[model samples]
Target: MSAPPSGPSLPKPESITASLLLGAMFNWALWGVLGCQTYLYHIYFPNDKAAFKYLIYGVFLFETAQTALNTHDTYIWFSRGFGDFLNFTKVLTSPLNTPMMGAVIALVVQLFYAHRIWTLRKSWLWFCMLLVGITLAQTGGAFYGGIRAFQAGSFVKAQTDPSNRRAVYVWLIGEAVADVLIAAAMVYLMILRRGQSHRFRSHGILARVVTITVESNCATASLAILSLIMFAGIPDTNYFTCPTIVIGKVYANTLLVSFNNRIVLRNLSQIGSPSFSSGSNIVTSSRLPLQKSTPSSAGRAFESDTITYTVHRFTETDSTTEKMDHELQETSAMKGSPSHHV
Candidate 1:
């Protein structure tokens, strides 16, 4: 935690020395929080399909394993090495691999969001493909960099090498690029869809969807960019480790929040109305049931606002926009109520 150490025996840069300790601690903390979020997601959304389940659980497991590795490395450095900053054994340096694992977790989240975008806007398949490619390339570079770091005996030594810089650059830059593209694509595609139907244009549901998408990806993208800038601009100083350690949790939590918010949206759509749920299909009508109208002077307000709530049900493999639309109409017709299109 000391400033850049300067001495004949200083085997590590001051930046890396502080980063190693801080990164391990931060990763463990975030991993614990992510575990709780994952448990809640499973408990609350038990009916989610296997694909959604596997995608989330897979990322959780990966993050857990990587955190364990980081903890083990931290232990080896502090306990086995007796706080010797000069210790350069592989055990002491193994935690460098955690960034690669972080990259994997991030890529998984990106793909999940990209899939959501694909479902809503099938025309953006090419853009989603580009995101997938960038993520894969980033993971590859992260693995390559990690393996080389594994081979090197010391952390600061590897950080100082020119050959090591390329892999680091590729991984960080690729991730930063992917983060920006995914966020931009999600927001843009949602806005594009808003223009598709004049009915949907005035609906707050599209705006809500866009807001959620932006909020989720904004945190992750900001962290990615900060980490990339520090890792690339600051050189040997491991100052970037702070953001790098927590970026994975941001990705994990993004998915968790997205999943849990579905129930809230469903409830909101039915405050003064009735809705029906058949299997994975949900149909909500904005029409009120038979009741006497309240007088305007009776301290009652009658707003003609229409709220459109869309539950994409990307959790189900067979769910689609067309199917949901058809079911909405069918359900409304069954109840003899007017249908509201989302």
Candidate 2:
């Protein structure tokens, strides 16, 4: 009789090594992008109120450190002696360790975002809560399950138990749900805000800043959702299987970094232009007549007529006639003034 069919092969060692390398590369590149974006945003907008920008920068730093650690671990796993490598994995994946710390940080950031959304007085509050809740649920589930598995020694357990597999399933499902919710909320918010363009009264710097904030958040949320979805299909075995997990992680990080960079660039471009408050004309009406010169012979007569000239001030009316008159007068004055004096 033919020998019994062999069971499905465990993931190959080579695959694991490749995955780890890729993951490390991905994280490094992602952080690099984040750093660049942060630099650009700060240089361009220089907004003291944007405390979250620093938080984002901190995230990039943490990711960079994590990437370095992961790279070391991957090297140990693939190139160092087997005993030494196994020891390294144990230390790195220990229940009470840096990986766990990183996971906690991630959760904290999500909660912070939720709090911000809760402060909004309109439908945004509900929308933000839903997105935040879904994200937290997924992230929390994965984190808790992973910790449990690590505690039970199932993370590296030789005999794959159904319980261990189930834990992974829960984590995956949670991540997927979170991704979908975040994506849906982002798209909805974008649509809602698009309708409010007509309500924007301010122009120049203020308007540009507001536009950037809205666009960046929407883009970041959308990218995050897309990355999460891409991660949903990753096999449970590949969680620590190396190359596959690494690839997915890299892609997600890159997307986030790219979105941030785009926002920063757009914001910077707006900052270089003449600000609306400084450049726009103000409309003011006066009953005073123009000053006329007296004739040398003292026989010339002149009639007094009301003349209106627009002044540059902080406030101006929205009347079309007033705006047209202001522009025409300004143009005429410019042409009549001596070029050297002006």
Per-residue CA lDDT of model 1 for 1-342, tens digit only, reads: 789967764325455567768777777787888888888777766766777788779878877777777777777766787666566234343535456777878788778777776766678789889889988888888788777776765656667766666887788788778877767875676566555534422234455556776787777777777877887787656677677776777778777777655544443333333545556655554554444444445234333345333332324344453454454443221111222223
Give the per-residue lDDT digits (tens) of candidate 2, residues 204-242.
222343344345445434443443443345443333433
**lDDT of the candidates, in the order given:** 0.65, 0.43
User: Residue 55 of model 2: what lDDT?
Assistant: 56
lDDT, model 1: 0.65
Position 253, candidate 1: lDDT? 77
Candidate 2 runs further than 4 Å off: 1-11, 82-91, 94-121, 124-127, 152-163, 199-342
In angstroms, how far off is 331's CA in candidate 2?
28
Model 1 RMSD in angstroms = 9.3
TM-score of each: 0.72, 0.53
